[model samples]
Target chain A: MPDTPAIEVRGVTRLFESRKGFLFREHTRTEALRGVDLAVRSGSIYGLLGPNGAGKTTLVKILSTLLLPTSGSARVLGHDVVEDSEWLRPRIGLVLGGERGLYNRVSARDNLRYFADLYGIPGGEREARIAAVLERVDLLAAADRRVEEFSRGMKQKLHIARGILHRPEVLFLDEPTIGLDPKSARETRKLVRSLVSDGVTILLTTHYMFEAEELCPEIAVLSKGRIVAHDTVAGLRQLVGGDRTLEAEAYGFDDREVDAVRRLPGVSKVVSEEYGPRTRLTLRLRSLQTSPDDVAAALPGHSELSVRERRTSLEDVYLDLVEEEAH
Target chain B: MTTVEVPRISRSRATSASLRLSFLMFMADPQWLIPSMIAPVVFGLVAFELFRGSGPYYLTYAILGAGMMSMWGQTLYGSGWAIGQDREFGTLEPTVQSPTPYVYVVLGRVLWNVISGLIGGGIVYLVVLAAAGSPPAVPDPVGFVVLFVFVMLTLASVGILFSAAWVYTRYSGFIQNVGEFAFYVGTGCMFPVVLLPFWTNPIALIFPPTWALDALRYLAIPGYVGFGWGFWPDIAGAVATTAIYVAIASTVFKRVELHVLSKGDLSDY
Candidate 1:
C-alpha cells in the first residue's frame, strides 16, 4: 500500500520509427514522449493537457503498461511497470480513445459481463456490478441491445462500464468526451466528477482546455514533449495575468495593419483570422488596458474598426500557449 | 446509507468470468456452431460411402480426418475471430489492463474453443462411425485418452500463434482468409497428406491436428491402425513446434502491446 502513488511516471520517453518521406529512404525517429516525470496523487482528478502530437496519450499508455518507454521507468499503484506489470494491470482501468473499445455486435450488458469475467469477478458479483454501471450511465434499459444499434453516446457509456467493471483504483480516460454532443458531453462530465467523488484517482488527457478546467483539480500543460506549465485552474489563469481578452472586427484591414496592432504596448499576444471579407482579431492584454484607442491609434488609417473587450478563458490561454510554441 | 452489499473480485472469480465470456462469445455466433457440426458430418458420410467396398479402412480414414478438420477449424478460427474482434472493438487493452493474468485470459479463450472444437468434431466422428457400422479399433483406452490430451494442447497453441500475428498487423480479414485457406488447401484437411507432394507430406505431419486425425482414423476403423501408428512421429513434431511458437509469439505480442501503449497508438486510427 505504501508503494502506491495512484500513478507514478518518471523520466519516461517513447520513440517511434517512421519513414520520413518519399525521397527520404532512411527512417526517422519520432520521440513521442521525452523524459516526462509526473505523479498523480491518490483521490485526485489529474488533467494532462497538450496540443496534438504532444505525447499525452503516450504517457498514459506507458503508465497503463500498454507501451514500454524507450528510456526511463514508470510504476502504477506501487508496481514496477516492466517488472511487476501483471500486478499493475488489476489496479487500473483505461478507456482508450476512439470508438473501437465496445463490442458493436453485443449488448452493453453482455460486453460488461465479458470484461467482468476477464477481470475475474464472480458471476453473481459481475452481474451486479454490470447492472449498477448500466444504471449509472442510464443505459440499463438498452443493456440488451446491440452496440451497433446504439447512438454514439450509448457506445461511449458501455465503454465506461467496461473500464471500471473491475473497480480499479486509478482510471485513465483518454479523450473520453471527444465528438460527443452537448447533452451527452454534459452527462459524461458529470459521470467523471462522480467517479472522482467516489475517491478514484482519474487521469484524463484532452486537447480541449476547458474540459480539463472543469474536471481536473491539477492541470499539466504538455507541449513539445515537455511540461510547459503545471498548476491548478486558478494558477493557470494567473499565468495569463488578467481574466479579460480584447477583440476587434475590422473590414478592409490588411495583414500589416493587424501586425501593427499586435505590436501595441501592453499587448501580451495577438491572433488574427480572416472571416470572409473581414478580419477578426483577438488580443490578450492585461485586462481592459488594451482599449479602442489602442486598436484605432495603432491601426492608423483604418476607420471601419470595431473593438469589443471580453473576459479571458482557458481557450485564450491555450491558443496563446500553442502560438508561443509556434513562434 | 449503510451498504447492504458490494461486489469484490478475486483471481478464481476472474478466471471463471473470462472462461464464461469466451464460451458465450463462441456460442452466440451461429456461423461458428453450425459449420462446426455440419462439415465433419458431411466428410464422415462421404468417406464412408466412397470406401464402403474398401471396408473399415475408409471408415477410419473418414472419422479421423473429419474430426481433425472440424477441431482445427474451431480452434484456429475461434482464436482468430475472438482476438480480431477484441482489436477491432478496442477491448484488447481494457482486457489487458484487468487484474487477470494475460496467460489465464488467453488460455480461457483457447480452452473454450478447444472444447467447442471437440464437441463439433466428435459429433461428426460419431455420425460417420455409426453410418459405417464399425466397432472401435484401438485396443488401449489410455493411449487414446492421452492422444486427445496432447492433441488439445498442441492444437490450442496454434490459436495463440495466429493471435500474435493478428495483434501486430491488425489484419483480421487477412488472418481469417489465410487460416481458412490453409486448413482447406495446405493443412491436408480436405485430403490426406499422402496425396500431397513428398516434401509437403512431412510438413503437414508437423501440425498436431494432422496427427490427431490420423490417430482417430486408426482407432475408429479396422485395418487403418498402421496409418495412425505411422502418425505418432508427426504428433511429437507438432507438440514440439507448437511449444516453440507459443513461447515466441507470447513475448512478441506483449512487446507490441507495450509499444502501442507507450506511443499512445491505441487511439491512433
Candidate 2:
C-alpha cells in the first residue's frame, strides 16, 4: 500500500450548469473536467500546469473532497475522496489558490492551530506542529500577527503553514507560490523539496514552467479539461521532437513571408506570433541544413527588417502545445 | 529535528478551540461590537423617557425590548455570517474538507452569540433598572429565571434554524436582515402584537420567541397581562415550539451541508 500512488483519479468529470437569465432561462453546461484521469506517485511532487480555466483548480478541489466530481472517481491515500472523505481529510491537506483560504481576522498562529485542529492533529502535539510549520514557512516571527496585516506572500506562507501543520500524507497546492516574491518562492520550493524527501506526496499547480521543471520530476499539463502532456521535464521537452527551432523577432513579419519561409526545403513548420507592432517568427526545422540565413533572406524579401535566431525553450513548447489544443 | 507520529484531532479540543477563537473575534471587533451594543440600549433609554407618562408598562417593555432586539441582531449576525464569512475568507471549502465535523465547528461559532445574548440581555436589564430608577418587581423569581433561560435557548434555536435555511439559499446576508426585522416586529419585542390585527397574532404564535417574550412578561413584570393565558401554558408553548424548531433546523442543516459539499459554495451573505 505504501507503493500505491498517493492520489488516483479516474475519469473525473465535473460539468457545471449555470442558468443564463433570471427568468425564461436556459441552462448552459460548461465541462470543467472532461473525464480527467491521473495518478500521482507517492512521495513525488506532481505539477499540474495549464492556462486559466483549464480545470486545474477543479481537479484539486475534487481530490481534496472540496467539490464532488459530477462523474468519475478520485482517491487520496487509497481512500475514495467521496465515500471516505472524513477518513481522507485527516491524511491530506490543501492550499487552494490565493489567500482566500485563511482567517484574515485571526493571527497566523491561530489560523494554523485552527486548521491543525480541523485535521484532527492531537492536542498534545499541536503547538510544536504549528511552530514547526511556521518555522518551515519562515513565518514564526510574524506568527502572532493578524493575517490581514500580513503581505500577500506572508499570507501565502501562513496558508502553507496551515497545509503542512498536520503533516499530511498527501498535499494539494494550487499555485502555492503564485503571489510570492522570488526569494520567498525559492524558500517555499525548498520547503516543498524537504517535504517530498520526508515522504510526503505533493500535487502542485503553477504557471511557472521553470519552477515546475525545478521542483516536479513528473508533470501533467492540462488544456481545456484534458491532459495534453504528462511526462518528465526532458520527456515533455522532447514533444518539440528533435526539431531545431529558430525564433526571429521581426517588424513586418506577415503570413505571406511566413509561407515563403515554410516553403524552404528544410523548414518543417513556421509559426508567426504577434508582439504588438513586431512579430516573433518561430521556424521549426527538421535538420541543421535549414539555414537561418536562407530563412531571413526569404523573410526580408517581404519587408521584414532585421532577423536573428533565438533558442527554443520549455515556455515555447508549453505555449505551442496549449495553442495546438486551443485549435 | 525529529518528527513524532502525527495525532488525530480531538473533537473536544477542536470544539473548545473553535469556541474560544470565535468568541474572541466577536469581542475584538470594535466596529461591529460597539455600534450593535450601544445603539439599541441608548435608543431604548431615550424612547423609554418619552413613553413613561403615556404607556403604563413602557419601562419594563423598553428594557426587555432592547435586550430582545440585541439578541435578535447578534444571533442573526452570528448564524448569518458563519458560512458566508468562510467563503468570503475562502475558508469554506477548506473547512468542509477538514476532518472535523462541520456541525461541531458551526455550533462552536454560534455559541458566542448565545453567550452574548445572555450577557447582553442581562446588561440591558441592569441598564433599564438604572434608567427606570427602580428594579421591576418579579412575581415569580424562579419562574422568571427559568423562563429567561428558555428564551435564550429559543432565540438560539431560531437563529440556528435561520442559518440552516440561509446556507441553502442564494441570498445570504439579506436573509439575516429580513429575518431580524421579521422576528423583531413579529415576536412582539417592541410593541404588543395585540395592537396589530388579530391575524398577525397567529403569525407571531408560529415562533417560540414570541411565546418566550409573552411568558417573560407574565413571569417577571407585576402589571403585565399576557394573551389571557397562565405563565405555565406560555412557558410550555415556548419550550415545545423551540424543540420543534431545533429538530427541523438540525435536519435541514444536514441536508444543506450535503448540498454544499456536493455542489460547492453557499450564498454570499
Candidate 3:
C-alpha cells in the first residue's frame, strides 16, 4: 500500500437548514457534521461505526461529493472535493445503502452497463468489466434478472457491482449491510475484502460493530457529529477492557426500564437489543470496580432478570463512546 | 482479477450516454409508450367530433392542437414529471453523484421526451386523418417541418429548464402537471390564442410553444398558409425564446447543483 492517503478529510462541517413553519418563521439549523477530520490509507478497509444521526453518512456524502461541506474540505485521490469534483467523480464509486437507486425495470446487467457508460467505460470493455463485477458479487447467475425482481440482498450485490465497475481507486459504502440477510452480508464482506486486497481503498459505515470488526482493519467511532474514538478493532475493544462488562436479560422489558437502567450509577453505557420475546441489555460499567450486583439492583423487575459478567465486544466500545454523550 | 485503469468519458460522450440510458429506461417500461400515444389521439377525437360541422379546418386544427398537447406532455410528464419519478425511485442521488454532469442527463431525458412527443404527434395525425376522411396537406412541407423541429427543440429547452427549477419544490409532479394543462389551454393548442380574452393573449404569446403552434398553423391550415410577416414571426420568436430559456436553464441548474450539494438532506445524498 502507498503511504499517501487515498481519502483525506480535514475539518469538514455541514449544516442543514430545517424548512418548517410558515413564511415568517425562522428556519432552524442542524449541524450534521462538525469539523470532522479523517484519513484512510490506500488499499485498506476503513470502517465508520455509528448509530443513526452520528453524521457517518454526512461525512460519507461529503467525501463522495454528493453533499458539499459547509466549511473545511475533503479530498479523494488528491483532488479537492468541491473544486475538482467534476474530475474526481469518475474516479470513485459509491453504494448508498437501502435505497432503490437502480432502475427497477432494467436488468441488473443493463443497470451496470448504463453506469459503466456514464463512468466512461468504453463500449468494448464495458461488458467485461460489468460481468467481472457481477461475478465478484456472486450475482452473475442473476445478471439478466430485472432489478425489481431481486431480493434486498441481490439489489445490494448489484450496487456493489456498479460501484466497482469502473475499477475506481476508492469505494464509499454507507451501511452496506444494513438490511441484508446473514449469508448476503457475509458475502458482501468477502467481496469487500477481495476489493481491498486488489489495492482498492474502501470507506464503509455501518451500525453493525461485528461487521466492522470482521471486515475493517481500522474503525472510527462517530457520535453526534464528532469522532470520539478511532483505532484498530482490537485496540478499540481494549478501550473499555474485554473482561469488565455486564450482560442482563430481562423478560417483558420496555423503554422506561431501559432508561432507568441507563441512569444507574457506574453505568457508562447501555445498548439494548430485542431477541424473540426478551430484551438483552449490554451495559459497560465505569470501571472494573463496578459489579453485576450494581446492575441487578437497578433492574426494574428483578424476578425475571438475569445478570452476568462477560467480555466486551466492539459493540461495547461503540456504546461506551456514543452513550457518554447521551448520559 | 487483473486490475484495469479507471474509466473516463468525454463530456460529449457523457451527454449522449445519459441520453441513451434515460431513453432506454423509458423503453424498459414499454407500458409508458401507451399513454403517450393515447392521450393525444383521444383528445384529438373529442375535439374533432365537436367541430365536425365546421369544415376540414376542424380536422387540421384538432390534429395540430393534439400534436402540441403530446409535445407538451413530453415536456411536462417525461421531463418534469420524470424528475419527480427519479426522486421517488431513489435514483436522483446516484445520478447527481455520478461524474457526468446531471444537466446532461436531464438534457438527455428531455430529448427522449421530445422523441416520445413525436410518436404521440404521429399517432394524433393518423387518427385524425382516418376520421376526417382525407389527409390535410401542408402548403409548405419544408417550412412546416423546419418550424416543427424548432418548436420541439424550444419546448424541450423549456422542459429542461422546468426540470432544473423544480428540484427545489420536491413536488415536481404537481407543478409540471399544472404547467402542462395551463399552457395547453393558454397556448391555444386546442383553440386560437387570439380568440382568448384580451387579457390572456400577452400571457400566451410569451410561451415559445404557443408561437411554435401558431407557426404550425401558418404552415398547415390552408386559410392561414402564408410566407408573410404573420408566418415568419412565430418561427423567429420560438427560436429566440428557446435560446433564452436554454441559457436560463443552464444557469439555474448550476445554482441548484451548488445549493443541493451544500444543503442537501440525507435522502438527497
Candidate 4:
C-alpha cells in the first residue's frame, strides 16, 4: 500500500461532442484526452506540462471527478475515479485556478463557510479550519472582504484556500500560479510544497517550466491529448537527448557541415532553425566530450560561425518533447 | 500536517446550509424581491377588480387565485433561477463535485423559495384585502391557513422537479420563461381548472398545484364545485400527484447529474 501510486491513470480517453446550427444540427466530436497513462507517487508533487489545449485541464477535471473519461480508467488512492467518485470526493481537493469559480459577491470567509458545510467539515472545527486555510494562503487580512473587491491574486489565493480547507489527501491544481506576480507566485509554489510536506499528493498542471522543475520531482509533458514524456527533470533532459546543449550559428550551413556537426562525439541530436539569413544549429550532447571548440572545429571555414555551450533546461526538454509529439 | 478525517455527508446539513446561503445571498441584494413581488401584486389587483361584483364569495376566489400565483412564481421560478445563478457564478462544478448530492442542494433552495413564496402570498393577501376593502369571509380560518401551507408544499414538489431542468441545460431559464404563462394557464393559477375547457382539466390535474389549489378553493369558497368530488378526493389527488413529482425529481436529479458529468459541461455556462 505504501508503494502503490497515489494516482494511477491507464489508457484513459475523453471525447467532447458539440452540436452546431439551429435548424439542421451538425454534430462534431473532439478528443480531449487520448489514451493517457500516468502514475504519481504519494506525498510528492507531480507536474503536468503542456501547451494550450493539451488536455491538461481535461485530465484534471476527470481526476477530480468533475468529468468522466470516455474509455479506460483512472484511480486515486486505489479508488476508481468513475465508480468511487463520491467516496473519493471528500478526500481530494481540486483547484481549477482562474478569475472565475468563486462567489464574487460574498466575503471570502462566508464563501469558505458555505463550502465547509458542503464538505461536511465538522461544525466544531469549521471556523478554525477556514481560518487556518486563509492564514495558510496569506488571505487572513482579507478574509472578511468581498471576493469581487479582491485582486486577481487574492481570488486565486482564496481558490486555493477553499481547495485545501478540508485538508484532502490529494490535491489537483490546474495552473495555480497563473496571472500571479512573482512574489505571489513564489508564495503559491511554497504553499504547494508545504501541502506536499503535509502528506498531500499533488498533481500540478503549469505552463511555467521553472516552476515545474523547482517543485515537481516527476513531470509529464502532454501534447495533443497524449502524454509524450513522463520523467523527472533530469530524466526528461536526458530523454530529449542530453544534459548539455551547444549552439552553432553561421550565415549558412551546407548539408555536409550540418552532418559533420551531427556526427560529433557525444552529440545526440542537432536541430537547425533559420533566423533571417543565418542558420542556428542546436546540438544536444549526452556527455561533455563535445565542447564549443569542438563544435567550431567540426564546422570550419566560416567567419560568421559562433559556437556556445550551456546546460539544457527543462524548458528545452518540454519544447523538444512537445515539438516531437506535434511532428 | 493536519489530517482531515473524511466527515460523513449529512443531507439535512447540506440542505440547511444551502438554505442559509440562499438567504444570505438574498439579503445581500434585496432588490431581487421587488421584481418577484411585482407579478403577484399585479395579479392580486386585477383579480380583485374582476371579482368584486361577481358574488359574496368572489373575494375569496380572487385572493386564492392571486395567492397561488404569487407562491407559484417564488417556489418555481425562484428555485430554477438559483440554479441558473450557480451556473453563471461558476460554482456549479464545485458544488456538484462535493460529497453532498445535488438534490439536497436544490431542496435547500426550494425550501428558501417556499418561505419567500409564503411571504409573497402574504403580500398578495394584504394587497387584495386593501383593494376589496375587506378580507374574504371564511367559515374555517384555521383550515384555510393549513390548506394554504399544503398548497405551497405541492408547489415545492413541482419546484424541485423544475429545478432539474436548470441543471440539465444552460438554456433552461429561457425555456422556463417561455413556458411561464403556459404553466400559469395550465395550472389555472388565476381561475379554477373547470372554468377552462373540459378537455384541459385532465391535463391540469397532472399538476399537484391544480389539485391542491382546487382543494384550497373548496375550503375557502362555499358551494365551490371543484371536480364535484368534494374535499377528500382533492386532497388525495394533491397528495398522489405531489408524491409522484417528488419521486420523479429524485430520479431526474440523478440522471441530470450523470448527464452533466458525462457531457463534462457543468461549467459550460
Q: List the residue pairs that clash in candidate 3.
A: none
Report, for every candidate in turn, its global Cα lDDT versus the true structure: 0.72, 0.77, 0.79, 0.91
Cα deviation in Å at residue A41, candidate 1? 3.4
Off by over 4 Å in 1: A1-5, A18-28, A122-124, A238-241, A252-265, A287-303, B1-16, B126-150, B171-207, B210-218, B222-269
Instruction: Give the higher-TM-score candidate: 1 or 4.
Output: 4
Give the alpha carbon lDDT tens digit for every residue of A213-305 in model 1. 888888887888877677787677667655667778877667788778777767766778788888888777765566867787777665777
**Each candidate's DockQ:** 0.44, 0.46, 0.43, 0.60
Please report the candidate that would top lDDT against the real structure. 4
lDDT of 3 by residue, A51-162 (tens): 8898988898888888889899798887899998887787788998575888898889888877776778888887888888888899999999888899998998888888
Query: Could you give the candidate ranking by TM-score, starting with the highest?
Result: 4, 2, 3, 1
TM-scores of the candidates are: 0.83, 0.89, 0.86, 0.96
Model 1 chain A worst lDDT window (10 residues):
A1-10
Residue-level lDDT of model 3, residues B1-269, one tens digit each, is 12245566666676676677777777788778667866777866876787677775777777777777777777657887667767777888887888777787788788878878888888888888888888775678777767777778878877888888666558667777667778878877777787778799789877777787787888778777332457678788877888888888889988888887876842541
Ordered list by DockQ, greatest first:
4, 2, 1, 3
> Worst ten-residue run, lDDT, model 2 chain A?
A301-310
Model 3 off-target regions past 4 Å?
A: A23-26, A241-310, B1-6, B28-34, B223-228, B266-269
**TM of chain B vs. native, candidate 4:** 0.95
TM-score of chain B of each: 0.78, 0.85, 0.89, 0.95
Determine which window of 10 residues in candidate 4 chain B has minimal summed lDDT. B1-10
Q: DockQ for the candidate 4 complex?
A: 0.60
Docking class of 1: acceptable
Question: In candidate 2, what are the lDDT values of residues B149-243, reduced to their tens digit?
Answer: 77877877777777766566656777676666777888887666667788899899888888888988886677667677867788889889988
